[model samples]
Target: MLLPMSIQAKSYGWGFKKNTNHQPPDVGVYKNILDDLGGYYLDNSGDKVVYLTFDNGYEEGYTGKVLDVLKEKKVPATFFVTGHYVEDQEQLVKRMVNEGHIVGNHSYHHPDFTKLSKAKMKEELESLEEAVAKITDQKEMQYVRPPRGTFNKQSIQWANELGYTHVFWSLAFVDWNTDSQKGWKKAYQQVMDQIHPGAVILLHTVSKDNAEALAYMIDDLRKQGYSFRSLDDLVMKDILPEPIIGF
Candidate 1:
């Protein structure tokens, strides 16, 4: 089913933004750092593959539709859900797990990790992990995305101590405007121009435009010789090579 064109686009409305000297997180906060956050694209010998991930802070009225498209496409994705979204949309959380999508921690309240005290930061990460464990019966939730794409040395170090590989993204569309839908052609072009193997893409389920255009984008990427997979797969084996374009 196609999402109505009349359905307005929506932003994540995380209630915060971060402006730092660091390069915007393409995999996680450490993507701009020398050491890097996690190894997403370490080996580039295979066909171009894209990693699709979503940040779930709250409901924006389009997530369910996005899930439907993903389900139909038989594509797996990773969802970084905040504690709030997880609790608020527990049923959807169950669906994600049941449908074989990876659900990682996006923090309890979606705070900027670098600004929070070390203890508080750790609490944020662990609390969300615990919440998911309670519902999914899974004890491990190792992937993370810092709220607002903000992080620092201490934040990354603390997360590592907690055993999380901070995940950011390399490609994104302007889907955060609640007033106007990000045009499908623009969204498709933005991604196609930057298509790379092991690239992590951040598209919010909040945007109806994203949901509507998703299937088409998937088909186009497949034709371009790129396969779609979840981030969980990238962490499990050495299937992707490190990106040569933006690192």
Candidate 2:
């Protein structure tokens, strides 16, 4: 099946949207392309499962607390850490692995991967993989979330060739700006209001608001019959048809 030009155009600048109705629009276009290319944006499991992920570019002061909450709740999450985070906080990264959390590659420098050449992109992934392997002793890092939520078809295909499953979120908010945090109540509402089945919720460990509201959010999500899953569990395998070359 040939991809529509409109879908291809949209893929270059696709950003996640928070659906109030909890129904993401015509993602088949995106999903079909990703499934064939070994990438993923949303999980359409139709079950009450939320894949919790955090983008840890660099630790602020809250990742430990965030990890503590996840530990208390016994919820598994994927933490996509940059090369700097791994280098600076080796123990924390080790703790994440020891605690049974999946550590994903967020690239070495956190550059907009859509802008890099295939070689540079591979370096971004490989350097992080080497660092993570040295720290966690887990040689195979299967998941990656592109920096700034920006990716193109070519970038996805390159990542696929490198044996990565690109992970994009189905739910996210403006929580990266620490100074702009509205409060825990507002954060809670922002997440709960858009909560849906099979939501890949993106949170930043840098946000104090997220640290404050995460436990409450977990409780509420469970009350609404949603359970958290790691990216390892949510990733689909053998679902893609033969690779469509030259995207």
Off by over 4 Å in 2: 1-11, 25-29, 236-247
Off by over 4 Å in 1: 1-46, 238-247
TM-score of each: 0.79, 0.88
TM-score of 2: 0.88
lDDT of 1 by residue, 163-220 (tens): 8887766666577676788576766666666666656778887777777778888988
Q: Candidate 2: worst 10 consecutive residues by lDDT?
A: 238-247
lDDT of 2 by residue, 1-247 (tens): 3445554444354565457886653454566667767666666757687888999998888999999999999999999999999999999999999998899989999998867878999999999999999978677899989888777677787787789888887888889998898888888888988888878888999999999999999998888887777776665423453321110
